[model samples]
Target: MMRGFDSYASIVFFLIGIAFVWESRKISESSYGSNVGPDIFPMGLGAILVLLSIRLFYEAMKAPKGDSDGKTTPDYKRFLMIAGAAALYAYYLEDIGYVIGTFLFLLFCFQTIQRGKLVTSLVVSASFSYGVYYLFVQILEGTLPGFPSWLQ
Candidate 1:
């Protein structure tokens, strides 16, 4: 079952990588005077993904069949929770402000994955959210939603 799943995943990822590489060709070959183009990164990443997927396929094919007949139950509840949180995060990111939305989403995900260690999860989530905001807005001179307009 694991082997079959891996094989399917590899095929899917391989196709996705091929699509990325094909679409990347639509971008301009170079930017300004620089020889390296914006498309290069995506093309290169796609090639890497293709190679990795091929490797996965090879490993899956070579794997010995196990005798264990019992199938493991998937954690669908956890998956649904994380998926819902991610959807909400994407929807509310701009409206709620990056820092607050990201922090809440990360905190929720962390707690959902592991119930205990509330303080640690809070600290890590807060640090990541604020750190990204500071790095992008203050340090890099890039704009991100800082706080909701009503707060200002």
Candidate 2:
């Protein structure tokens, strides 16, 4: 891994996270009389991003100074595949619903990053997708497109 790249990325991510948090604050609180505001997700996500970026920066700095100039080729095919999947996920989300769409997307991404271990990938993807859906819809009283009618 390129040490310089990681350091630079950490800085960029830190800034982006800060921006997310800052911008999310502008959103109006409480939509349609619901306790959960539209800003809640973005604010929480931004906070998490900021924390993660700080950790990334710390790890990047603390890690040993490895090859600072190792130029590895980017995998275009995998990039295209993941990009295609993301686009399809966005396009089909309303129709397919959040849990299934997110699960499929995460599964595709995890498998793309590392093939094999289908069980691990499937379980992780499913758990995260369902957990998020449950948390948002039930606990937070937030609405999300649930399973498609076909599945229900």
Candidate 3:
């Protein structure tokens, strides 16, 4: 089971690395000043992820096999719940706006999937969503979704 988890994590990292590498190619050097290009960070991070994945894969391969002692299997229901919440978030992101969608996502994650306290989950989710919104919209001056004219 441990080895399986390691293998899965390694493969995920490997795929992420590949994605980063592919994305890096799209960033043109001319887009950035002579100092640095957008591709540089992506390529560097991709290489690091690839190296880490390789190391993890090797370690997992060398790890000892499972013991005779019985071990409990992972909770598939919980996994499904988390996956469902993520899917919901992705589906509603554009319609609900980032802040509201993210808050609802976090609340669902903490309350339904993680089984956290109601008050704690609500507070944390609201704070995190607001913080992210403020950072992106106010500090970074990034465009965010606004109420649609029709909705107004």
Candidate 4:
């Protein structure tokens, strides 16, 4: 069951990655007065996604045969919660701003995946969200919502 699910998920992710890469190509390269291109992030993400999906497929294929006792069940509730968080993050990204939205989303996901370790989750989430924000806004000169107006 796990093997079948992994294979199917990997294929889906692979297609999504391909689509991302393809669509990114249509974006005009380089923002005005900036050396970094708008498409760089998406393209890089797409590439990473493709590579990881391939790896997932390999892992699924290499998994040893196991007895499929009907006792094991997939955690649909957890999956749905994470999916909803992801959707909200995407929908309100501009409104909530990148740093805040990403931090909250990542934190939620990390905690959902493994409960406890609040400090570690907070540190990692803060680091990733702020790090990416800085990379794009400061270094790359790409536009991303930094903070909501109320936070100013």
Best by lDDT: 4
Q: Model 4, range 23-50, lDDT digits (tens) per residue?
A: 9999998778777888898999999999
lDDT by residue for model 3 (15-61), tens: 99989988998888544223355576789899899999999988887
TM-score of 1: 0.66
Candidate 2, residue 75: Cα displacement in angstroms equals 2.6
- Ranking of candidates on TM-score, top first: 2, 4, 1, 3
Give the residue spans of candidate 3 off by over 4 A: 28-70, 147-152
- Candidate 1 Cα errors over 4 Å, as ranges: 21-70
Model 4, runs deviating above 4 Å: 1-3, 67-71
**Candidates 3 and 4 compared by TM-score, better number:** 4
| Alpha-carbon lDDT, every model | 0.87, 0.89, 0.78, 0.91
Best by TM-score: 2
Candidate with better lDDT, 3 vs 4: 4
lDDT of candidate 4? Answer: 0.91
> lDDT-based ranking, best first?
4, 2, 1, 3
lDDT (tens digit, per residue) of candidate 1 on 52-89: 99999898888778722236767899999999999999
Estimate TM-scores for all models. Answer: 0.66, 0.88, 0.63, 0.84
Two-way lDDT contest, 1 vs 4, winner: 4
